[model samples]
Target chain A: MPVNHSRQKRGIAISPKNNSPVSLFFEGAKDTFPLIVGAIPFGIIFGTLAATAGLSFGATMGMSLFVFAGASQFVCVSLVTAGVAWPMIVLTTFVVNLRHMLYGATMVFFYKNLNPLWKMVLAFGLTDETFAVAVSRYSKNDGVPGKHYYNLGSMVFMYGNWNLCTFIGLTAGKAFPGISQWGLDFAMPATFIGIVIPYLVSKPMWASVITAGTVSILAGGLPHKLGLMMAALAGVAAGVICEKVFSEKKERI
Target chain B: MFETGIQLYEIYMVAGMALVTFGIRYIMFPLSGRLRFPELFERGLRYVPPVVLTAIIVPSVLMPTGETLNLKLNNPYLIGAITACAVGGLFKNLLLTIVVSMAVFLGAQWAFAMGW
Candidate 1:
């Protein structure tokens, strides 16, 4: 398992304890708390911006309640504000959210044996922060059963926090009219930096980050935010190629 | 004087976004049991998080305005992101990283605005 392999390489001991479903669930929520902090500004900003974008309070809250993805919601609201057609707005949302497909694929290994209902519920909650927290927990070979409960916990916590923040933003936006311009949106990127920096433990990872970062900046002008998808692909390709090349060199030596 | 709170097109748009977003997220779940990916492809998937996150972060920090690059020292976002990267590298604590970075970001913004 990648968890065991990485832990061994890092000289960290894997805990041998097994956790009950209840504990795992709460642990999931607790571990995801910091990420929720990062997401607060993001959720609130979305609400505030959506309100300003001419989305009714109902529509703004509806997006949070149903769509539940921060980045895509932002894109959708921005497109609406631009006076784009509804179909085009939806298409952009689809494109913006395609990264979640990769997340879903990564998570499939853990949920393959789960019941359909459990799988569906968990999949709906698979945002970037939840995935970050849950994957690290799942990756640990701590022999924990019902790890999906941990995911459920994080999901519920995040869902609640997001909606609450959106509500705050909606109310605050009307009051302050300048809350969105306070640079609060920096929280998301700061949180992302925290997530990514720790994963840069290998050359392939570094290659992936550098390539993706550069490509995203260079292609940032692409229509409908397609640059994000392009940058992601380029980054993954770079990582895979570097991994192969480096492993081949080790074999040759 | 007849006004429903939300317009019909807005409802349609939100519904469409919800459907597609859920479709992307849930598509793999139903197929989970029946699907087995190649090992090479699986390896590539591990890179997805870092890559996707970096793609998002790079643009947000470098182009906070969403229209132009802001690499100058006065750009609080750039300063804050760099602070975050360094702090996270050294400490590896998520909350600490966020708190410290946000403080730095705000401080930078204040200083620049004050002509300091």
Candidate 2:
């Protein structure tokens, strides 16, 4: 009865009854393009950095494929470079990736009617960027399927792009001495700002960000980048406390 | 380094870390039916920055020197970083942030090289 139940695999959208859903999936893909474009450069940098940190090419790409997690992989490289014990390296990576649990849980609710096979396939691929795209689509369209295809497609695309670019970067980083001095490293912060600024258009969010940024600066010198963690905790704590303190006020858009 | 014998110590550490990561990732699966978390937990999760972003950005900004701010005029990296944040906020563009920060830092270094 739904618009996408038929011709699910071919991506045909012309059926009078089934056009909307196929279009919606493509729509999801279109939305994810920026994220993939983002993946290319970010992946290149990760590869370059991992090599700079002394990881082998096989290890870096393997980490990307097996973990498919950008930041935690970087942390692993950092820990290894610093000669931290292997156990702690693993623990830190796990702790840093804890946010994925929330993502898996939230997206699962959307795909509730789908078979369990699709759920397992998707649960592993849902990263923040894909989750953002999927959540916005679900909220806007209301007819989105309870399946995880969009998340799967986006994640797989990004993962492939990243590994490819990372390999390119790894080769270049090794071949060219002092390559980092050329200033390609600035891409990382700029990317985060690009993402964060759009989210700060709302006032409460503005408060939350400023609080986090300032606190991070204050705690910038803490060991093991723990200050950064505290800053995040502080920022979100501020948001939650502010919301609770003002609960009695009438709700306004 | 560990072609065949990475050592039990290393194995335990890496495997332990892997387990921790797995536990964190599937954190919700075990609790889906067991506990009634307060609304605060849900609210906290929503308000928090995505985990990867927080770990990446926060650590780099706070501890670029490996453990300290490494603050000093000679540390052009810090200047470049701050320039990234300020210019990043004003323009809200990624390319501009990368360009401006790198340019300013390199420009400053150039001037310094010229005895400014």
Candidate 3:
């Protein structure tokens, strides 16, 4: 007779832990390498641009390491270079990274049952790539990926990618080799376009996009670069109102 | 060089910057503690992305001359970016979206270089 062991139990289907800590730390560097190949050049450009924009290498690296979002960092450096005040810099960063707030709200549904440390670490480790991966994994037919390890690995990889590439770019991110005549600066707007396209997945999403675009257009000239703040607030306001109205109507029906 | 009045230490400023960033990120941490946000607040939060993303990217697309308006006739980046958006919504693929938009940007810039 074949021996069938019914003793083993799967707790939420994550994984059997094997040398968890060391593995988690390096996993970030390894898995994110493919993404990093593209990201590094971008990081290098941000660093080089930041250097030209008058940030110290330490500050540049610190911002890249600690924060890890590209558009917001670019806006922060650009605005500072343009001589916007300190408060405006802080506000701009908030406005730009505000999207992550949405990511947090959605993740709470999946992660609420996790321990405090997991919640805190997941919150801290939140980034575009990690969140995108984690949320999809959490929502799919299969359960979340080795929840802690997957995110930890991706975060670590991304952190190394951003910092190291930034250092390299700072040292040697010349426009000459890439052929400045080629208009490589479009990478940013192009990237934003890439993100925005994925988001037109629903009615509310579409509403948010139009609202964000319109308000941003209207508030484009706010002083101290406050236009961005207004745009963010306006976009959120429009979408929220529409959603509320839609839901209320559905309930009434 | 004036290095005295009103200036902060380098390390302190770095810490301050990091603190400010973390503070902004942690703002969403309270979501759990509140069993429910003000009904209005919850609804609005749902719509935040579209509004904010538009605000973030529109200027990049439309405002090349700083404050002046440059439409399809003048700036090619805007045209390419818009096409990329259409491609993205239609195709629903990141790779295709990136490739299409990037090609638009490069092609337009190249044409400009060749003076065509």
Collision pairs in model 3: A28-A153, A28-A157, A29-A157, A208-B50, A209-B50, A212-B51, A235-B51
lDDT by residue (tens digit), candidate 3, B74-103: 477787778778887787765566667777
Candidate with best TM-score = 1
Which one wins on lDDT?
Answer: 1
Winner of 1 and 3 under DockQ = 1
Residue-level lDDT tens digits of model 2 in A24-71 = 456557666756655666677777777777665666666676666776
lDDT (Cα, 0-100) at A91 in candidate 1? 89
Q: Where does model 3 exceed 4 Å of error?
A: A1-41, A79-106, A128-133, A136-150, A174-182, A244-253, B1-8
For candidate 1, give the lDDT.
0.89
The candidates' DockQ values read 0.65, 0.30, 0.39
Q: Give the higher-lDDT candidate: 2 or 3.
A: 3
lDDT by residue (tens digit), candidate 3, A7-96:
233442345653365665455445444444445557877777776767777777777877677767777777767887766576666666
Candidate 1 has an fnat equal to 0.79
At residue B77, give the lDDT of candidate 3: 75
- Higher-scoring candidate on lDDT, 1 or 2: 1
